[model samples]
Target: MTKIKIKESKASTSIPTANPENLKKQHRKKKRKILWKNKVKHVGKKKEDTKAMRVLPPKAPQEFSSNWKTLQELLKQKATSFDKSLPVTQTYSKNHTSKKENVKGIPAISGGGKMGKFKSVNKMDCDPAQTSVPLATLKSERTATDKNSTEGKGNSKEHKKRKNSDIEKEQADIKHKRRKSEEHMEQHLEADIWFDDVDPDDIEAAIGPEAAKVARRKMGIEDKPQLSVEQVLVKEKAFAGLTKAVAMDCEMVGVGPQGEDSILARVSIVNQFGKCIYDKHVKPTEKVTDYRTAVSGIRPKDLKKGEEFKSVQKEVADILKGRILVGHAVHNDLKILFLDHPKKKIRDTQRYKPFRKEVKSGRPSLKLLCEKLLNVKVQTSEHCSIQDAQAAMRLYTLVKKQWEANINAKSKRKCVA
Candidate 1:
C-alpha cells in the first residue's frame, strides 16, 4: 500500500548529436578490432591433419658399390662358361707317329670321309697321246669352225638385203602400173561442154543483136574482155532523181513473253539505184530477251558494238525526214521505229496491186514478188536486211512508172471529189 515517486531518466528523452568524422573514426577502430579478433582466431587454431599438409621425408643419395661388385662377378662367370664351351684340338707327340704315315705329311680326312694325303701327279702321265698330237691340226679345226659361223652370219645379212631389194622393186613396179592405168584413162576420157553451142547469127535473127550478144555471154560461149585497172576503179553510178526515195528494211528481235515482243535490232536502207544508204545495228533500251537470228539475221554478236537506241532513232529520223519511204511492210517498220510518215509518201511493195495478181484483200510477200516479177530470189534461209531492202527497191523500180501514174490518178480523183 506504499506508493514511492521516482525521477525519470533524461537520457531516453533527448538525442545526442556527434561529429560525423569522429563517428567514422570510431566505426573504423571497431572494424579493426573485429578483423584482429578474426585473424587471431584463425592463427591460434591448429591446422587439419590432412595428407596434403604432411611433410615428406628426403630421399637418400644413390651408391653403386654393391651393384658394381655384382656386375663384375657376372662378367667373370660369363668368361669361365665361354672358355669351357670352346672346342679343343688334340696334339700327338713325335713318338706316337706310324711308319706308313711318316713317309708323307699328316693324313687329313676330307668331306668324303676318306683318309688320304695330297700328292703331286705328272700331267704327261694322264694322257700321253693327247700331248703327242700336233698343234697345227687343232688350229685348223678352230679356224674351220670360225669360218662356218662367219659364213652363216654373212648368208643371213645377204638374204635380208635381197629381200629388201625385191620388196622395193615390187613397189616400184606397182607404182609404174598405176601411172600407166591413169594415163590410159585420161587419154580415153573426153572433156565436157557446159553449154550448147548457139549460133550467134541465129540468135540475132530470133531476137536482136544486142540480145544475142547477152545470150552468148550467159551461155559461156563468149567471154567478156577483162576491164583495165582504170575501169575497175570507176565509182558507182550516182542516184540522180531518186534522192527523195529510199527503201528501208528493219530486222526485229524478241524481248518479252517467250520472245513474242518485237524489238528493232537492225535497220538497212537502200537508194533507188539499189545502193546501200544506211545500215546500223540498234541496241535496245530494255534487256534483249531474244535474237530472232533465223529470220532477222541478227546475232547477239551483231549488237555488241551497236549504237544506242536513242542515237540510232535520231539518225534514222534525220535520214527519213521529208523523204518517200519504200519498204515491204512500211507500216510495221515505222511502228517498230516509233516513227510516223505521211500515207502518200509511203510506198509498200506488199500493198502494190500490180505486184500480185490478187487485186484485193491478200497481200504478197516481198520475197514472192521478187521471185515472180523481178525474177530474183531473196530470203532463202536467214533474211539479210540489206538484201531485202535491195530486193524491195528493185521491185519498186520495176513498176515505178506505172505505180506513180496510178498514184497520181488516184490523187487527182480525190482532189476532184
Candidate 2:
C-alpha cells in the first residue's frame, strides 16, 4: 500500500518494479476475504480504472531521413542588402554573460519513495548503457576535490591563491549583472556592412533646365517619378489638411576659383495651397565650384539660355502667394529668388531634427533626412531637384504630424486642467 524506492547500485545487479501482474497478485492476496465473498468473471467487460501500458520487448532497429529539396532551393537564391542599421548601444563595458558553475545535491533515499545516487550526465557517455546523472552529484564531487587538495597543501603560493579568489569573485559579480541585462536585451539579431564613399560621381554634366513643364521627369528617372500638382494635392490631402506648404529646391552653379564662390546656378521655389507653382533654374555668370557641382550634379554646360530669371521670379511669387513656404536651410532658396521673403511664413525643418546641432545623425543632405525620418530614400546617386523638393515636403509633413499631435495633446491637457 506504500511506494518503496528500492535502489540498485554496486550492492545489487537488479531492481524490483510494480508490474501489473505483480500488483494484481499483491491486491488479491491482501483482500482474500472480500474476493472470496464476491467472485467475478474476467470474460466480457473492461475496467475503466485499469488503463496500464502493456509491457513488451524493446523496439527493433530503424533508420531516419528528411527531405533535402528545401535546402537546395535556398542555396540557389543568394541575396544581399544593406538595411540592417540599428540604434547604437550605450556602452561596451555594460555587456556581460554568465552560466551556472554548480548544482546542489539530491537527498539520499533509504527505502522511501525518494530519488538518490545522482550521476554526471555531462556528455559522460553517449552509449546506450548511459544512466541519467543528477548535476548536483558532479558539483559536490568538484567541491570536495578542491577542499581536499587545499587541506593537503600547508603552504600554497599566497599570491596565486589570492588571485584565484579575486577572479572568482569578479566572475560571480559579472554573472549577476549579465543575468539582469539579458531580460532587457531579448531582441531580433541583425548585421550590416560599413562603407563610406562620400560621393562617387562619374559624369559632370550640368543639370539640364528645370524639368520642362510638359516633359515629365518621371519618364526618364526610375526612382523619382515627377508628381503632378494634382498628384501632390491628392497625397497631401490624404495625409493632412489641403492647406499644405511646398518646398522647391533649385541648385545653381558656383563661380569662384580662390575667393568665395559666386552663384553660378540658381534653385528657385514657389509655395502655395490650391495654386499653380513655378520652380526654375538660372544659368550662372561664372564657373560652377567643384563642391557645389558635385552636390547639385549641375555641370557647366546644362544651364542654357531659354527663359529670363526676371520672368520666372514673377511666376514664383504668384504660385507661393497662398501657401506656406517650407524648406530646409531656406535662406539660400529665398536669396536665389532675389526677393528676401518674410521670415514669418517660412518653416525651416533645419531649425529642428535631422539638421539640428543636437542630432548627430541629421545630415544637411535632404536624402539622408528623408531616409532616416520618412523611411523613404530619395536620390543618393544623383541630384534630382524635383526628388529633393518632394523629399523635403514629405519630411516636413512627417515632422508636422508629430508636432501637431504634441500640440493637440498639450492643448487638451490645458483645457481639462
Candidate 3:
C-alpha cells in the first residue's frame, strides 16, 4: 500500500571532491617544468647576449598618446646630429594587395592603461646609440678664441721660452769686466777674502814710517760695479757677519799743485783690525835732500837706486783696496796717494768728523780724536798699527749707529731687528 503511487526521481550528478595532495603534486610538477625552462634559457644564448646588449637606463614610460608618430620625428631629429644610414624597406605582396606600397607603420597606442604607448615596429626597425662631441659647442669655443687666445696649445711651451731667455741673459753678463768696476763690486767683499796660510815669503820687513810708505798707486784697474754689486746682493749674508773693521793708515809722498814734482817714496797700509797686510820702504823717485836723513829717515846708503814709482803702484793699491783709510787728515793722504794710486773705495774718519760736533773741526789730528774719544794717545812714541785701527773702527761704529737709528725711525721699525 505504501508503494501504490510510483514516483520517478531524476538525480543530478555530483562533482567529485578534489584531492589537495594530488593537486599539490601536479602543481609542483608544473612549477618544476617552468623552472627547468627558465634554467635552460639562463644557461643558453641569454647569458651570451648580456655582454653584447649593454644595459641601458630604463626608458621613460610613454608621455604622449600618439607616441608611434614621434618615433619618426625622433629619428629624424637624431639623424640631423649624426651620420645618416637609413634603410627604408618596402615589401611588395600578392594579388588584391593595393598597387600603393605601405611605408613602415608606427604601432598605435592608447593612453592611461598599464601598457605604455609604443613606437614604430617594423622588420627594418633598429635601436640607435652613438656618441660624439657636440658640433655647436665645439664651433662656439673656436669662435671665441679667434687667435686672441690659444685654444689648442699647451701652457708648457710658453714657460720654456721664458726660461730660456732668462738663462741667455745671465750667460751674457758674465764675460766682460773692468778694474774700477771690479773694485766697486767687491767693496763689500774685502773682509770675506782670506789671507790665512799664505806664503811667508810674501811678508815684508820695513823700518818704522819708511816701511809702510809705499802702499797705494793709480795703476790701471777696471771700474765696473755691476758684477760685484749683483754678487753682494746675492751674497749679503757673507758680508753681514764681518765684525772686524780693517783700517788702512796710508802714507804717500807729498805732491805739489801741478803734481809735476812726483816725490814718490813711502806708502804704508795698516789694517786697524790688528792686521798688517803691507809695509814697505819704497825707494824714492828723485834724489832725497840730505837734510831728510833725521826726519824722513832716508839714508843715502839704504836707498835702492833706480826704483821707479810706477813699479810700486800696484803694491800700494792692493793694500788700501778693501780697508777703511785713516790719517790725521785722510784728504791729504788721498791727494798724496791719487798721484799714484787710483782713489777706489776709501772711507775717511775725518770726513765723518763733522758729525762729531764735540770733536775739533778743520781736520783734527787722529791722535787728538783718539785721546778725546778713546782716552788713549796714539803716535806718542811710535805709530802703533793696532791702536790706530782701533780708533778708526770705534769712530766708524759710532757713525754707523747714528745712521741705523735714522733708518729705523723713518721706517717705524725696531733697530737691529
Candidate 4:
C-alpha cells in the first residue's frame, strides 16, 4: 500500500562510494605538497641560523660541524687554483716499509642501514671531517713519486746535491725578501720619526728657519685635525708605556788643552714618545777652552743660568735609575756625567748591529741614521741635543722588540748559568 506514495525520487537512494585508487592518489599528492613546504621551511631556517652564527665566537671542535663544513667547502674551491701536495709522513717499522707504500684507505660508510638506526659510527669519517683530496691530485702525486724514484735509481748522490743546492737557493731568496721587507718598513716608518712634541720656535732657535718650517708643517700648528676618542686613547696608552724608557744626549764643551777633552755643557733627555722630559745647561767644573758654539748651540749666556754640575748629576742619576737608557754613544754621555749604568740597561743606537747594517758603517752617527732610516735631516746648522736625543729614541723604537729580546735572552742565560 506504501508503493502508491513511493513514486520515483529525483535523488539517488544508494550512498555514493569513493574510488579507492583516486583517494590514494589525492592523499599522496597532499602529502607530497606538505613535505615540499616543510623542506623549504627547514632549509630557510638553517640558512638564517648560519648567518646569525657568523658574528659569534668560534665554537669548540665538538660544538660545531656546520663551520667545519663551510671551511672544507672554501678549501675545496681554493684547491682549484692553489693546490698543494700534502707532506708525506713515514712510519718506522721492524719490517722496513717501501717509501711508496699506499696510504691506508678510509673505512667505508658504517652504521648506515635500518638496523644501525642510520646513525654514524665513525665520527671522523663524517662529511665535515672526511678528506676531500681530489682524485686527480692523488694520481699526480703518485706519478711524481714514481718519476723521482726512477730518476734517483742511478745518481742518488747527484740528486741529493741538487736538492741541497735548491734548499740553499730558497734560503737566499728568503733572506733577500726579508731585507726588502725591512727596507719597506723603514720607508713607511719615516713619517713617525718627526718630533711632533718639539715646538716650532725651539726648532727655529736651535736649528734654522728651514727646519722650523718643516716642524711647523709636521706638527700641524695651524691646521691640526681633531682626533677622535679612540685615537686619543691609543696615543695616551703609547705615551704611558714610554715612562719606562728614556733617551739622553749631552752637548760637550772642550775643557782640556788643545780643546780635545770635553765636558758636559747641556744635557737633554727625551721619553720614547720624543717628548723632552729633562733639559738643563750645566756649569762645568773645568773651565771651557772651546764652547763649540757652531755644534753644541751652547752660548756663554745659556750656561750663565745653568744648574750646578753635582746637582745635575744627582738628578740625572735618580731619573735614569731602574730605567732603560737609550741614546747615541751612551757610554760617552755616562762617562762625562761621572755615572755608571748597567751595560744591559743601555740601548745604544750607534752600536746596534741592525742600525750599523742599515748604514753600512762600523759606527753609524745619529745624524746619518736619522737621515737614512728616519728620512729627517738633523744638525743642519746648530746641533740641538734635544733633537739628537729624539732621533736616537726613534731609532731605538724601530728595533725595540729585537733589542729587548736580545737583552732578555742574555739575562736569562746568565741567570741560568
Q: Pick the candidate with the highest lDDT.
A: 4
Per-residue lDDT of candidate 3, residues 1-417 (tens digit)? 366876554432232235567677878999999999989988887778876676443366552223333444543443333322333332123112322333222233333323333444431333322111233534554455454346435566778889999998877666444555766645534433334443222321221211112121111223323233123112232332222334544333333543335454555453433334454555765545441433334445545642555656666565555544544345554565563333333456666544456575666666677656544555565444334554665565545567445545856754445
Models 1 onward score TM values of 0.44, 0.36, 0.32, 0.43
For model 4, which pairs clash? none
Model 4 lDDT at residue 105 = 29
Q: Model 4, range 262-375, lDDT digits (tens) per residue? A: 988988888878777899999878888899999899888988899999999999999899999999999999999999998878888888897888789999887788777755
Clashes of 1: 0
Q: Per-residue lDDT tens digits of candidate 1, residues 1-417?
A: 999998877874442335577678878999999999998877665454344455443233343243233433433443344444545431132223322232222223344535466443222122221112223534565576579789999999999999999999999999999999976654443122123477755655444445555556557667435444222212267663346789899999998878888888998888877777788998876777878788988888898878988888888898889988899888999999999988998999888875656323378887677555544567789988888877777777767889889999999999999
lDDT of 2 by residue, 92-116 (tens): 2222210122111223333443467
Model 2 TM-score, all chains together:
0.36
Q: How many residue pairs clash in each candidate?
A: 0, 9, 27, 0
Would you list the C-alpha lDDT of every candidate in the order shown? 0.68, 0.50, 0.46, 0.72
2 versus 4: better TM-score goes to: 4
Q: Model 3 residue 74 lDDT?
A: 42
Prediction 4 TM-score vs. true: 0.43
User: If the candidates were sorted by their TM-score against the true structure, best first, what order would they fall in?
Assistant: 1, 4, 2, 3
Superposed by TM-score, candidate 3 places the C-alpha of residue 355 at a distance from the truth, in angstroms, of 5.9
Question: Candidate 4: where is the Cα deviation over 4 Å?
Answer: 1-242
Q: In terms of lDDT, which candidate is stronger, 1 or 3? A: 1
